[model samples]
Target: ASITERFEPAISWDQVARLREIWKGAMVTKGPLGAQDVVRAVELGCDGVYLSNHGGRQLDQVAHPLDLLVAARRAVGRKTTILLDSGIRCGADVAIALACGADYCLVGRPYLYGLAAAGQAGVEFVIGMIAEELGRTLQLLGLAGVADLKAAGEGVVRYGGSPASRPGDTGDFGVLQ
Candidate 1:
């Protein structure tokens, strides 16, 4: 059977609250995409909210995780730490996620790719490349750290398509609030 089918696929609120009562360390819930679910996780005592689409492996046509970050942040406010994963292959991707409101990004495939390509050296190379790109992105955006990304907001990243791809002659499109 598949991994999803092998285990109990459903979770209950009582189970989450009970587990939180028994655990000493931080508790987090992963793969929740809705703002209401994020808010509910906080109510259930989750220390963090992990936004993911299972790397787009679990379902088709799900919203991009980055696109959901802002709503999740608004739903939970600043009290809960919101994290994101999936489709993050580089440092710039990391920066974009943060600017969109993710407190942290969890990378999986990039590390796995590095490991499969050349072991330790490849892993180190990938890490260094991401760090370098992060630094350059910060400098170019005139920001000092990742925390400053919150202020950069939606203008820092562009979704949809290239500017030239738009057929209109007007330059009056405003940022979505």
Candidate 2:
């Protein structure tokens, strides 16, 4: 409740402009699920926008990070960077985020799982596993590289409708979409 109250006002453009003078390193604003907030961030000269619902730990009924990627991409266009951090468990999820317009996706629980299981070695193992899986996923999707995944677009990542009945839809194309 306290955190919710504190965030009620949201950050102002003036505040970001002021912070830009002091913070020399990269500045990324997170926790927004709307295009307007993203536009504001870009206007303020933010380095990037990290799209997140705090893993759904902050609020309920928040749109999935992948879903937000579409609107964010349209709002920011291709030049501005976009990152996602929510419900991404494996390489497949990473692929979906990228196709949906996310430049990069952040995984949180996976790292924590690695840490809880076996410290640094576990983290290394997890990273290796994800990398291998991502490579395989790309290959299976007939993609040559991460850049190729973007070509898949929303056609590869479906949310909750019947695949065949999706009007003009042909088939699953082997991905979630």
Candidate 3:
């Protein structure tokens, strides 16, 4: 049989509920683009919700997970675990995600690229590089560590153009002053 003929594209809420009942391990639902869907997933007994846009590969203009993350976190509160993927290229991205309320961030393509380039060593190198970048970012932000980054919350990130106080300031876009 051809791939399309054998593949089932639809999965209903009932199926998800059933899977939750049968599966004793942690269950996380991926691809939630808004707070409502995040709340719905939690209502359905999901242990976590993974916010992603599939790296913008699935759709032309899907909402970015980072854009939706703050509201999702507000809707779900702090108890339920929230995982974010898509567009996480560096450790600074991870810090931003955590500050915005993701409990954990998932990195895919970078490590995969490393794996393809030079096996385990490449993956290690990429991870180390990311870690070093994150460390530097934290230092620049006057933060001690990841715990401090999470504790700092959204205050650490400033979006869009620079403020009037420092006109023509062309510093980093996301890092707050």
Candidate 4:
């Protein structure tokens, strides 16, 4: 069959409900860009909601997952798992996601690039690089570990641009050094 003929433009919530009914394993709904959708997925029995913009390849100028993450977390509370992806190119990005409220981050492109360059070894190298960078980022933030990120919450990162008047604003709440 042709791609157009096979592709379904929309998947109804009823379909997701049916899937939840039959699938015993954890069910995660991907590509939710708004808090409402994230909450909706949880209400529909999805084990987790994956926040992504498909690398913005599917649609131009879509909201980045990071932009929506905080609100999603607030809407769903801490109990429902929230997985984040898209524009996550570095360990600091993972830390930022976790600080903002993601329980897990899906790193796709870097590992794929590694695989393409040197198969399994390349993939391992990329993973190691990311982990090392994350450790460095945590250290710089004065955090003891990943759990500290959760404890600090959004305080670990500065949102918007740092205030010019403050000049080295580490003392301020939510301002990163």
Candidate 5:
């Protein structure tokens, strides 16, 4: 699809399951979409939807996760969870995701970096680092577990909302989109 096309290129709802892919290098590229893909996901009794573009890595010049978040939420409504993960790098990303009606967020690159650095140990270290940071953050803000956060994550500030909203952007097509 062109960068200018949002939903204009949409296919029918029944054809997405049979969607085809185009291979490039070692990558598998998706053909296109059908609305029933979303509806089918709903009919299959999903609790939520994930509106991520693999951190923009799956396809070049594709929209980022945040850019797709609002529309996805509007499609799924409040009954389902709308989780996001693509380029989230810090606590601020998590905060914005929650604020924008996302039920959950995941950090892909950070853990991957940890994994690259030291395998399982690197992953554990990253988790420990996050735990330590959260502890310090909670202590400074007088907050408890994540469930204890209010409008924001206590001491953490918003990263000025999602990263995709900025001007002069192409698209992020790396880190699994």
Candidate 6:
């Protein structure tokens, strides 16, 4: 059987193989390029990577890391500590990141305002807000517990990126085609 036929809840090399096949043809580099950059990064001894075009805010228009995250993860294999932190703003986003294969995430702007707004107190407030919002967000999705979040995607996807040919496909933003 093929990789798809071997997918398991525990996830295996077969599952990873399937992902690579689907996304290998999808990786892209800056403004449309080749796949060598990704290969080069790994060969250079980088243990992990984060795919981003500076959160799309810097580029004005670019592919979402969500698409690149999957492709990148598959490119490097499961051992890589792949982390992504662009355009993530909600608890649902957290789920999406993990689903797309982010080992860790980074949220940038939220803390800046808290530091500027009320110093330490403001920062605490922002933390609380994020926690409350994340919990509520997960609760609404029937994921009352964080562990339950493992089964994300529910097969529901919101895709984008011109390089990505599928409906929401945005392939890879900056990666060389």
lDDT string, candidate 4, 1-177, tens digits: 877699888888899999999998999999886888888899999989988888878754877887788889889998899988887777887887888889999899999999999999999999999999889999998889999988888656764422211445544433344
Best by TM-score: 4
Q: Each candidate: what lDDT?
A: 0.76, 0.77, 0.81, 0.82, 0.53, 0.56
Which parts of model 6 have CA positions greater than 4 angstroms off? Answer: 1-36, 144-147, 151-177
lDDT of 5 at 10: 55
Q: Every model's Cα RMSD, please?
A: 4.8, 3.8, 3.9, 4.4, 10.0, 14.5
Candidate 3 lDDT, tens digit per residue, 1-177? 876689777777788889999999999998876899889888989999998888888754987788788888889898789999888898778777887788999898999999999999999999998889888888888999989988888767654322211444455555555
State TM-scores per candidate: 0.83, 0.81, 0.85, 0.86, 0.56, 0.60
Top lDDT hit = 4
Tell me the tens digit of each residue's lDDT in model 1 across 55-110. 88875478767767877887887799988998888877877777777888888888
Superposition TM-score, candidate 3 onto the true structure: 0.85
Residues forming the 10-long window of minimal summed lDDT in candidate 3: 159-168
Report model 4's TM-score to 2 decimal places.
Answer: 0.86
Candidate 6 lDDT tens digits, 68-88: 666666666676666667776
**Range of the 10 consecutive residues with the lowest summed lDDT in candidate 6:** 26-35
Give the alpha carbon lDDT tens digit for every residue of 133-167 in model 2: 88887888788988878876756565442321257
Off by over 4 Å in 1: 1-5, 161-177
